[model samples]
Target: MYTLLIADDERAIREGISRSVSWSDIGIGRVLLAANGKEAYDIIMKERPDIVLTDIIMPVYTGIELVEKVKDTMPQVQFIILSGYNDFAYAQKAIQNEVKQYLLKPCDAESIRKSVQKAVSRIRDIEKKEQFIASMKENVEKLFPQAKEQFFRDLVHGSPNTQNIEAYKELFNVHDGPYRMLLFRIDDNDYVKLLTLKSLVERNFGEENVTFCIIINTAVVLLTTLTGFHELSGLVEKTQKQCYANFNIEATVAVSSEGCISNAAQMYKEIRDIIRFEFYLGEGRIITKDDISVFRNDYSLDTGIQTEELSAAIRTGNIDSVKSITNCVFNAYRMKGYDINRIRACGIELFIIVLKHCEDCEINAWIKNITRINECNTASEIKQFILDFAVKLAERTYQSVISSQNRVIEKVIRYVHENLDDENLSLQHIASDILYLNVDYLGKLFKKETGMRFSQYLLKVRMEKAKELIKASSGDIKVYEIANATGFSNNPSYFTQVFKKYTGCVPKEFRETGKQEEKDSGWLPL
Candidate 1:
């Protein structure tokens, strides 16, 4: 439903319009009324109503003045002027302004309803176009970040077509530089807030003398033959003020380390270098070429003592400490505008450091499952992986309780395989193999890893051995005799039950079906 505004100086006209029209029936739900042109303009700016029905002459400002003030800003708004004096001059002025219609005051409800319906239809069409663009962009985002950035760039830079005209760039602080680039930012977006930001810059900073293409949702590139740095600063500084005053937005502008020739793509990369300053300067703000500087120093993830301490922690899975260090590293780079690929590469580098001091076995295999594919394609992806693994590994390791369980997991797996025939074995059998861990605690670990009771694995193993004995023999044998030898204790009836579960048949039937006696070889799964 579209929003409708009724503005007039006369109380009777306002009340009559409100009471006479079935606005809800015409797809307008919210109705705002203003007593003067100034008040109506305030509503139009704030609420951005689809239709405005206003009296031609009002106390503070006339409908003509209202149209003059707001039409350029909101050109799509449909306006119908109302007047008590049906003078030819008033109608001609309204027609010149392209007002939808000039109605004699106290017009019938049917006349107003027709205008309202037409306005709603126009709004619906605009909404459909917006929805289609949003959906198409949404699908493209899921493919990859690089693809998403390229799509945004192509959208703004590509030609509109032979049948269409393109809007000119509106430069604010930009000057006559040899090359120009735009930095677009969508605020508060976990998703494509970037797109909104890009759109805003195109509106505020575009110009005919300059040609620009969006490089990503968050930035654009413009190139021109004009030259002058002072003029450039003037343009950016002014654009900054208008953005906040007009749109309630704050976006950062980054000047390239050096301006490029009038090549759009090359100029884009040159400007992109300034993005590195986003870390030191921060996001949601601008950093220009002057803001960035170079040094002869080189630094890796490790910085002397910090590296030493962090590497040691990662080696032993002293995860809480590792988490603290990982945070420092990721935050430093992420603030620099590095994407996930850079982040994950840092993660891999840290892992390598950890690997230097510790065995692969010391590192949790579960972490390998999580980093799953640590192939770093971009800075952002890598950074994200590091951030994710750093936190989770910390939780798994230094949550303080799991460390003992880790050892117990390893020890029990070794013990179970070594003494498979000992169905009499219990958690107590594990105490000597892994020192300093309790029997009850050991039972928990055994179950967590092997997914069976400690006693259950032993029983399964004995049954497995019994199956082989039955199949290997050419001579007849009873199940009880085989059960006692394979450590079934003294329960003959239970042994046959356990054997049936493992082999999916009664022992006698299983032995008979395997009449190609020599063919029944190993007891493992096929």
Candidate 2:
């Protein structure tokens, strides 16, 4: 549920709002009340509630001033403007602030609830879009670190990263370095503060050498990185000087060590370590690597079962066997609770291997898949996905290999078709042309690659040719002529008998049937 802040000069209204209609029902679980705009502003600076309700007229600071202040610093805070006066000026001010609803003085509970509900829905939707973009950026970074490098290059140099996917995601990419993390507190992240910080950073230290991502107006996370952990020491000094001179707010910097940012999900723990130790910083101050070094966690999260071996097995077309290996590996890891980072690394290797194989084999693939897998921080889950994916891959490979092996027979058949007129085109000739072994071995391979013996196949070949030749020739050719024309010489009667044995009919009869079949099949004869 979203948190809410109620600000009004009238104590009765403030107290009444705190008790009335259960703000929790309207998606507000936590509600705070302030008697005037000044008190409301202070509360906002501290709590940073999602929604604020204020009257236009309040003590010390008008609700209009409060709204403007909050809008300038905390643009995300939804507001409902309340006014007793029905003047056009007050309504104009409300409109300027983008107030969701303007409630009259003593507005009923339903009116307030409805307005807040709508604001909740809008904020939630905005949050979801933001999350989606964040996820996209994360995936793109892991898959395309070069793109990430360019993003940081542009960001540090005060240029847009070409306004592409990573740029539009508003994500900062880190280079190959050991980075530290820090979570800091801010007054508010209104558009003014966000743009101001961005502008100041761009103007002050526009260093071509260093890369950074500065997303202001965010109270929770300020993700930044140093080229090296040692650079983090310098970063602390630089961040301190800037925070003191510019925003004057207390901020904490969590420094992560140098490693692959592809494992950034693990680094979140490092940042949270800083958050948990935030009280150690006392007031707003820069906490260097030395200060936070003692608290760093060497603990690794659980990565699901790894299946890279299975993926490799699949790529090589070792199907059912590799799948069994995957299951056994999963059981072992799940039982032992292996280090997740290591498992995740293996899963990444599988993806890389698959990508490399696809490239080497010159196969077409959907490129985005590699990006998605690379972005995943959880190793075991990736491994299982790879294994599952490999199962199908292995099956396909097996079928393909079978098909290729099976084509040898077809090749032998084709060789015969091309060289049938050569009397020397026997089993030895056919096997040699198709690159088979010795004649004896070629005969065995021929039967294996096809489903017929060499001698039988040759008979089938010659008989079919004889029938076609007889049907094609219009003149009544002599029997001996037909025999000599079709790989037999000087003995037409012998050729006819061989043809009769194969087709259960003499060559002439076979030709007569073929001619009739062709005529029935709509052949336009010459």
Candidate 3:
């Protein structure tokens, strides 16, 4: 919607133009009327109408003077001049003022409507251009941070073109000279704390000198024009202290070796690799490349035996032995003053071993625990984590072993029932020859599970089958056939002896009176 203002000294002219003109049809929502130039100027200042119509000659001030005064401030406001005379001087003055249209006194409604329609169209065009510029600005602001982060990431990853480096530096307004990369490992993922830390760093080191971004849960700070490591270290320390004080966050910062912008990528990688040594350096401390270089000597961490011992202990479900082996490995690392990187590397290797062992035991829960390997800040913490993890692995492994043993026992019982007539279904045949398990272990497991020795259980099973066969045959089947069917080796005399011991009767007598005796003895059918 648009507004229109009509100014003329004549009451009839002002009222006539306001009433006669179909302003609403021409996109003008309101029509403002004024008696003179002074009144019109006041309304223009207050209302800022989109279009204005004023007489060339007016009281107190002329239309020319009104336009000249307000033109500079309200450049978007359109003006149309009205005059009784066709004076070339007034036409020249209106042209100088950039008035949209000029008309004589008896202008028709069609002429007035046409002028307003043109003015409304110009206003809409100007507004559209302004809106487009505003939208572009909003999009640029949103993408600026992402662009800056990408630029730094490319610089560090050795992918940025050196030819365009200066152009990008100018774009981001980075200063020339000594710059260092500081990688801080933040243990918390709270976005609020991350943002708070970022703001504090920016505030301490002027926003232009520092560019920070979160990469893989770690904050990377690019420091420009840093005087020396001393100054950078102090600023990082203060920032760390402030974060702890304000947000209750603990962080460990690693400073890369200082160099010019050209080496920034290498510096970033170096610091990233150095920070992994925090497992030995402890958190809430600043570690620099120089700090760890002194400890980086050719020292071999012979963890082969220790790892094997730990693996063996875990296999046997010995929690105490697993903890002892873990402690010894870490103690040797501490006592020998091994390189932090080597220590971390060995810890990772040990974790992998544990992971593989867990997989062999079919324990899947330990797989997720691998992520915590990087969270340890000291050798003791790493030891403790490994101990706790090994304990869980051992428990699951033990349960798995028990479950496997039970399955074997069940298979053996099934084989015994299926092969009772073979006369070769002894414990040795099942454990050594068929199942290929340790004979002694299988015997103990079978006895412990069934609460009877293997031979005793076998005898009980054979005798029970014999009783079923006797009842099922109803004296039609011979006693020798029953003995052969029940793994008695076709020996009727021996079968009768065992059957008498089991049922307190000979097979023939039992077969003859077994049905009547079953009712008195409360013996249920198999």
Better of 1 and 2 by TM-score: 2
- Measured with C-alpha atoms, the lDDT of residue 424 in candidate 3 is 67
lDDT (Cα) of model 1: 0.63
lDDT of 1 by residue, 1-526 (tens): 7788999888888878878888899898888999998999999999998899888898778998898888899988988888888799988888888786777866798988887787788778878998998998887656544543343354334423211222212212233245655554423333344444444455555556444434453344444333455676666666666656655766567665345422344555545655544434655565665555431022234344666777666545676678677667666766776546445544555554443442345555533543543566665555455556555554554544566667657766676667655656556756655455677766677778778776676666676678778867875877777876676658877877766656666778787776533433333322
Residue 155 lDDT, candidate 1, scale 0-100: 35
| Per-model TM against the reference | 0.29, 0.33, 0.52
1 versus 3: better TM-score goes to: 3
Among the numbered candidates, top lDDT falls to: 3
What tens digits encode model 3's per-residue C-alpha lDDT throughout 65-117?
A: 98998899998899999899899999999998899799997898788778888
Q: How does residue 279 of candidate 1 score in lDDT?
A: 34
Give the Cα-based TM-score of candidate 2 against the true structure.
0.33
Ranking by TM-score: 3, 2, 1
Candidate 3 ranges with C-alpha deviation above 4 Å: 84-92, 158-171, 186-209, 220-225, 239-250, 260-263, 279-284, 294-526
